[model samples]
Structures are given as structure tokens and as C-alpha cells.
Target: MASPLDRGGLPGHRVSVSPLDTAAAARHVATTEDGQRLSLAEQVAQVPTDPGCYLWKDASGEVIYVGKAKNLRARMKQYVQLTDDREKIPLMMQLVASFDYIVVDNEHEALVLERNLIGQYHPYFNVDYKDDKSYPYIAVTHGDVFPAIKYTREKHKPKTRYYGPYTDARAARETIDTIRKVTPICSATCAEWKRVRRLLDKRPDDAGIIGLICAQKGRPCFDYHVGRGPGVCAGMISPEEYAVNVRRVERFLSGHRSELTRELKEDMSEAAAELDFERAGRIKRRLDVVDGLDDRQQVVFPTSVDIDLIGFYREETIAGACVFAVREGRTVRTCEFIVDKGLDVAEDELVAGFVKRYYDETADIPAEVDVAVDLEDADVIGQWLSAKRGRKCTVHRPQRGEKRHLLETCERNARHALMRYMMRTGYADDRTNQALLQLESALALDGPPMRIECFDISTLHGRFTVASMVVFTDGRPDKSQYRRFKIRTELDEANDFASMSEVLGRRYAPERMADERFGSRPDLLVVDGGKPQLTAAMRQLEQLGLDIPVCGLAKADEEVFVPWDDTPVVLPSGSASLYLMKQVRDESHRFAITFHRELRDRAMTVSVLDEVEGVGPTRKRAIMRHFGSMKRLRAATVDEIAAVKGIPAAVAQAVYDTLRA
Candidate 1:
């Protein structure tokens, strides 16, 4: 369902694979600490920070688990920390005495390596999708030159254009039908056709040829086209037309949809214009047939044309970066980066760092590299990449339009990817329990809360009071389904009831909630505080004539506050519903804190640094550049940090001593 790099970042940027790459990582799998061997920590530290695929081999040198990571160090570290009883992982760990790897340049390369290795080795842990019969492909025969439609499970062999690994036989059949009507090709084997042609050419004083043409020409044949009428012969397509059609099939297989559509449209127009009403109707029908097949094409995005764009961000102790491959401004591939303590380096520098260190030795480089985020000197970096590529490489940030959307999508994917990476490495949790599940079970509802909405209000003397409503479906927090509301009741500090009431009144107002796509009338509603908060929410919904099930999650004992319930319903801590509630509660708390922090930090920032004349962008860059971070720069020395560019020696010295003092 997800790509191999969806597992994580590959070594640096070269997403290629080579043997001996795993040797270094294997040695790092276990390290000596305090006279005792601690395999995990040592393994994490020793993993090469290059792009590649890693194998987990048993004592017999058989690969058990294969994986890829953008940062081999972090990924290996994650595996090192797999202390839980994941059956396959633990088994693989015990069997894996060593490993092998092939380093490549980027996550996509890593993905290719992983898939190839899986196909080659058929590792035990990986999903082995059997049923060769189910994978129906459209194959063109090499010997025939004008190949017939054949269902197959084979890979794309040389000299033959294999169109699919189609999941459904009916779908494949429909495709074949569309192809037959659109192109001048026959489904019968060339041998059968040639034999029919020989008999016809000889004009062997027989009506067989006429019968065959009539049977097979306009109507279907024994392959379910004709229902035992005069048997049709498999000899309609002329040899030349068959050859031309075969080429068309190749174009169709190779992702030339627009070309196929254009040809179909032309044929339809010609048929109609020629006054061949019957033929014109047939052509128009064929055009409609092909139009419906557009979704089945391999290339989903219609406008993507380029290879990739890359971006990065650094925060506190973690650095995040994403390399988005664009095919016509649509992201077809992405590589995420997470580096620890990489604060001083800009994301563009990191991108440039990866490109230079990687593609410099590789043969593949995309035409243009777009940066969603900026670098200090983008043009210089672009020039560097261009020189290495031996082509005019242009790097630009999108101001607006589809490019921006591409960048945003890439960023969103990168965030999800980084989260996935962290989850894999045990740095974070991925499992989400639906908060509605807990509410329903605790309330003894008819079914799992299909739509459970939780409301939480945060305020400081009612100045920046805001309420957030989060939705959960099937016991999981669906953040995309969440909403935030700014309080506007003109109430004083700590007026939690009015804040709750106002938020509810706006959310359920018919005009707003009536949008079918956002048809989020909750099966259950939950407020974050005790009885008073729950009552306020319920009264507002009641006044609005919405009879939604309402409850309160008491912060004190984390008990459920329900309507007409005297005793609080306490769910088991380990129950699925409780787990869902915990997750939603935690998320809301996080969201609230994050919003509050932004507001707090805005006024709390130290303005003294801004007052300094020498603290321009260049000087600031130099300060952070040499010292590695703002924190370190603040603690730097006048002469000890004097090497920084743009900063006066006196200013550098003063900055260093001032922060130190």
C-alpha cells in the first residue's frame, strides 16, 4: 500500500543499491558498552548515513527482513529499539546474525532496491501475493509482430509490451473490448488468421470464406461474441492494419493517453462527417468507451512532467527535509529527511548537500529541481547542481498555483512520512483509537460512535479564547475531520460555559453543517470538562433542535459525564474505547498547547538581538553558521567565533561575551 521509502529516508540522496553496503550497518547492529554488548544502540550509531537497502539475515545468511531508510542511522536505531514482541521482527532479529545492503541515491532508488530484493529473495516476512491467475495483463507477442490479446501473469519481458498486472479479469476483458473497438486489431492468433487468409487467397471454390467473414467480421465469435450462429472466422484484421494496431497498443501501454484519446476523437469525427451514421454512432460509442478507461491509466496525474523537487526544515533537535519528484508539477515521489542537531544548516543547503554528494556520482538527475521552501542562496546552489549535471538546472520556489499545491501535498506527505519513520523506529506511536468508541461504550450506545465529536476550549482572560472540535471515526482520531472555532460571546475571563455554548451554536447552524460532504452531525458529542461544560454544550444543541447524544470527559477522574446519568461510566484503561479517548484527549491537549505557545512566544521573544545593527541576515547567518545554532551562537566568543563572515570582529566578540555572561 505504501512505498519502501514510505518506510523512511534512504541514505543521503543516491537511491541506488550496491552490495557490501550492509556490511557497515551490520557491524553497528551491536556495540560494546560498559564491558557488555548492547546491540541496538551500537547498531543505530554505526549505520551509514547513505541511501540504500538493508537486509536482516539469519545465522544461515538467508535474508529474513529487508528495509530502506533515508537515514540509515535513525532507522537502524528504531530496529535496535524494537523491544516489543512483534513476532516476525523478533524472529528475524534472532535469526539475523548479519546483514547485506546496497547503497543508492534517494528513497525511490531505495524502494526499487527493496522491491527487487523482495522479488529476488522472497523474504519470509514480506507479503507474498500469490494467485498468478488473478493478475491478468495485456501482452503483445514478439513473433507475431501483430500480437493478439492474451491474458498473462508474466513480468514485462523484452520485445513485448505488457500493459498490466490488472487485479480483475472482468476489468481486463472490458479493456480488451475497448481496445478492439478503438484499434484495428483482431483477438485471434496470427496462425489461425494466416490459415484463413491462405484459404481465402486461394479462392478455394467454397462459401467458407464468405461465411467466416460474415460470422467473425461484424458479430462476436466462439469467444462469447457469437451465440452459435454462423461461426465467425478469426480473419478480419488485414496484416498491415494488424501491425499498425500493435504499435498503437504499445503507445497505449507506455502511457500515451492523450494520443489514444486524440486518435479515438479523430476517428469519431471522421465517421460522423462522412455521413456513415451507423459507423459514426459506433465510433462515438467507442470514444465514450475509451473515455471511461482513463482512470485505469498508469499515470494518474495529467500535468506532471518533471522528475523532482526537494525541501527541508530543522527544529529543536530534529531536522526534517523532503525531496518531492515532480512529473508536471505533481509529486510522484518523495524523500524525507530527519537529522538530529542539524540546526545551523538551511534546508536548501541540506538539499544541495544531498544532490552534490549523491547525483555527482550517479547517472540520473531530473531536469529541474523545485524548492518548496527557500535557501539562503538558491541561485548559487542551482548553479552548483547544474554544473554537476552538465545541464541548465533551474531551481525556483512556486509563488502560487498548482506548484504551491504540489509543494503543500509534498510537505503533508513528508510530515506523514516522517511520522511513519518515527513510528517504525519506536520514536513515536501510530495507532489511533476512535474517541467516539469510548463515548459510545461508556454511554452504552446502540453502536460504535460512527461520528464522535469532542470539544475543548482554551482561553486566557477571554482575550484569545478558542475552542477546538475534534472528530473520531471507528475509534480513531481523524484529524482532517477536526475543526477550530474562535470564541465571540463577549464574555469575561473563565466564562467556559458561554464559550462552549457559542462554539456549539455556530457549528450546528443548518446552513453551515448542511454541506453533504461535511455532513458531520455527530452520533455523539463530548465536551472536555465536567458537568457544567457538558450541560452548556447540550443546551446549545437542544436550542438549535439537534438531539445529538452528549457527554463530558471529566478531566479530574477521566470519567464519562452523560445525560441523565448519576454515576460516571468508567471505561477500563486498556479497553479499545478508552485508548481512543486517551489519544483524542492527548491530541487536543497538544493542539491547544501548540496554539497557545505560538501566541505566548510572539510576545516573549527577546528583542535585544534585533536592536543590534550588526545582526543583519548575513551576520546572523554567519553567527548561526559557525556556532551551529542560535543557542551555541549566543554562547560563542568574540575572537573564538571571529571566523564568521559579515560579522565585525568587535560585534562577534561582544555577542559571544554578552551571551556567555
Candidate 2:
């Protein structure tokens, strides 16, 4: 094995530990000593004058950066010369890692790979980084039973109407909002409105129903009010109409671009014939927008069965694979994930592995499987799945036809889609999205909160009290950042406020928050409650001198609160901001309740066993395991319980008596 000192003679070798500059790192790789298999001059002698991607790695076989080169030889030589300033090349060179290159046939391929790799490894110093702002998509929940149109940075649902994957989310949102003003679909579900109308027309203690009726009927909603008049939504769209619109959206999202295009065109013509120029203009513009989108689709075909098509490419540690599921040849699910590949697996295998891992437990699966490359054991997987579901399962790798071309086009799309998602989520290059960027802006903080701590408390009958703290970095959930605390300080009493304070104190007591990897002072703190709870949190932070700006989410009113602020900031109840807070609060609640239930169940389950002197936890576990669940155990005959590995008949009889009593 090569000693660490083997890198001592490399240029900029000692400067890597300091603050790293991305541009400087790229520059350093360009000028550093040739740690290649051949000398710089020798490698340059054979350099191919082709467009391709160049890779730079440190001595330890880690990808530090990936770049595209229009001229492989020239780009390679620039690094060989070592003439750049130390400031530019300093940190990257300090690692003095070896490097490699792949010569693609064209600059486009190189560009594609460069984006793919950067997104995959997210090297510390790769410039031209992609951010979420660079990709956006239009979301039409209108695909669901009660559809709401919106814009999304990332889609969580498949087969939803998603437009663009646009380079600008704000623009997309503005456009969609404008369109919504023209068409105000009722936000209330059929069930909700029906219940409300029934209760208002008759019943009253159903104040919740009455409140909803008043809210919807007192004035035109924001969407309707935005348009010319209350006439926009004088009557809620009937279920039939809603279903028709949903089917149209489904068709559009299923990759039936022409269907969406046709609808837009028809709407435009109808508006024109009705002498509604403004409405006509809206429809016309939408037509143009849909047309523009349709033209951008890499594959356009009409078919029946839904299928997920996938493809892949890789350079060293960085690999890129794209998966696009097509329903009747229209793309329903287009996604890409960046991963590392040390094994020499085929691109097809990589795609398959990703599909399995990603959709392992997914509730939705396409009807057909499509691919660009065939797997060796497709039958094994297909058979296993078929037997499991009692359905015919076939995996097809199309060759030499429209299907093949479609698959290939989908593969290309998958590549770009993966790259775009990586960039948007800041996942390419294995980096966290600045979750705190929004938090900082919302709170006006000096810097991004590298560590964000949110606390939630859960209790049942003032027993089994528990609190959980969930961490978010860069706007995404980080499970590793999660921490849980059992309410131990006050055993017999459940004081949520005190429990919260104790958990927060335990988490930040220097001994916990002082670890560099695990320890960073939160720029922002959130508590899962309204004003009073927030006040309690503030006092705790103040007492600790943590002095972090704290806020609380009120579940009842769906408001965000800062202490001393009289009026709570009310975010749109369904806005992404609200959604995020809901997720955080829900996660914290889930974690706390999960821990609480474990304690409660453990005590509850074992107490019944412990009442029997001869029975212990081991024998109890054996009985429960054999019986499957508590219900089964309760219903099991004493003889059946006794048959469990270690439970004696007397112990089983005692347990039976204890449970019955």
C-alpha cells in the first residue's frame, strides 16, 4: 500500500486542508505535478483532440471534481503547465490525487456527463454547480379527485401532470397562478362540500361543517376573486366535470401531449367564439405554452400500457442513470439518481438496481417494464414478481424499432432529468440543499442554519411522555440528524413544556452539540405549538443562553409564531411552507409517539407476563413471536402458548390468567 507521504511531492499538496476555492481547485488540478501513469508531456503526446469529460481524483481514489473539455489535449496540457496562481489551485493540488479521462464523441455527450458527474459526487470544488433554481416543474394535482394546480420544485407523486422540469420555478408558478385565476375549481372535495351543505341546510352542532360552508359561500375564494367576477365559480364543478378534467390531466401526464394540446386549442377557440378576448388570450397563451412543452418532449407516442424506461452512464466514482416510466408511450415518471459504482456493472444493471431500490415498497408500479439493455436474470425477477402478484410480468429491452428509439430517447431524458433533480435538490455531489436558506431568509438570519432543531412532544393520559427533535439541513429531512428523549426526569408526571425544555437542554448541553460532526448551534429553532408553547421554548433558550431565534407552528390555526409578535404569520394552509412545517411537526410527532408507544407497549406487554412469577421476558417474547400479534396471543389457547419455544404450560396458564384478568 502507498504511504500517505507518497503525495508529499505533489504541487499544492499541503494547502488542501485550508478553505477550498472551487475555481482554484479546478485550476490547481490543471497545473499540479503529473501524478499520472505517464508524464504530463507523454500523456499530452497521445491526447485525443475530442470533446469529452475529464476527471480529477485524490490519491485515495475519491472523485474530487469532474469537468467537460472541448479540447481534451489542450485542457490536459493546461493542467500540465502548472502556471496558475496558488490561490486558484491551492487546495485541490494539496491532495495530489491521480486523475483519468473519458473521450466522448461530442461536446454534448461531454456536457451531459459533466452535469451527471457533478450532480453525482458534488465535489467540494466543482464550479458551474447547478441549483434548484435551474429546474422547475408545474404540478397539477388536478390529476387527483379534487385537483389543485400548483408549481413544485420536486414531485413526490408519479403520473401527475408535471410540466417543464423548467429552468425557472417562479416563472412556472406565476404562469400557473395566472391560469388558475381564469379557471377556479372548487378547493373543497365533493364529500366535504356535500357534508357542509347538508349540515348548513339542516344541522348545526356540526360547526366544522357550518364553518366550511361559510368560508366557501361568504365570498368568492382567492382564485375566483382574482378573475373578473364571482361568476368564475358561481357553481362548483360537478364530480363528472371534475372527473373529465382529471382524465384530461391524466392523459397529459401519461405523456399524451396531443390530448393536452387539443384541449388547450379547443378552449382557445371556444373563448374566441364567445367574444371573450381576455379568456381567449389566456387560452391562446396556454396553447402556446403547451405547444412549446410538447415540442420539447424527447419522445412522443400514443400507446396503452404504462412502462418505466431507464438508461445509464458513468465516469469513475460518479455514475448517472435515468428512469422514465411511460404509460402508453407517454412519460409518466421521469427521474434520475446519482450514485457511486466501484464494481464494473453494466449500465443496464445499474439502472435495474436503482429501480428496485427506489421502488422497493412503492405503492404504484407501471404495467410494463421497458429498457435499453437487457438484464441477465430478468426472468428471475419477473417470475418472482409475477408469482407474488399472480400476474404475467415481462421485461422488454426493445431493439431496432420505434419502441427501441423511444426507449433510447427516454434514456436520454432520464440522464437530463437525473442531472436536473440532483442540481435542484443539491444532491448531485452528495451535498445538502441549504434547508436553512429559506429559514434564514424567512427569519433574516446572518448565516444559513447548518443545524436546525425542531421539537415536538407527545403524551397519552400524562403517562409515557416523550419528546423528539428532528433536524433539517438545506430544506430536506436528515434522519441522521434526528434525536429522541424519553421523559425520565419527571417519571410519574407528564409535563410537555418541561419535557420539551429538558429534551432541548439535553441535546445542546455542550457535551451533545459540541461534537463538530453532530454539533452546530442552530440559527433557528421551531417548536410544535402556538404562542404559549413558543413562549416556553423561548424562556428555555434564554435560560440556556443559546439565544437562538425561535418560532412555533400552531396546529389548530396553522400559523407560525415568534414570541412578542401579536399577530401570527398565517401561511397559506396548503403552501409548501406549511407543508414543510407539517412534515417537520409530523415527523417529530411520529418519532415521539413511536418512542412513547414502544415504552408503553413494552411496559404493557411485559407487565402481564411479569405478573406470573415463572415467566420472564425471554419466554414472553417467544410466546408473542409465535402468536404474531397481541390479538393472536390473547386468543391463543394456553396449550398453544405453552408450545412456544420456552413457555411452560404453567407459565402460559399464568399469562392467560393475567391477560384475562
Please give, for residues 131-201, the per-residue lDDT of candidate 2 as tens digits: 32334556665333345555665534654545544334465556554344333344333344334345544
**Tens digit of per-residue lDDT, candidate 1, span 88-157:** 3443565656555556766545554565566557665553331113345667665543356655666545
- What is the lDDT of every predicted structure here? 0.58, 0.59
lDDT of 1 at 402: 60
Best by lDDT: 2
Candidate 2 accuracy as lDDT: 0.59
The true-versus-predicted C-alpha distance at residue 64 of model 2, in Å, is: 46
- The TM-score obtained by model 2 is 0.38
Worst 10 residues of 2 by lDDT: 12-21
* Reference-based TM-score of each model: 0.37, 0.38
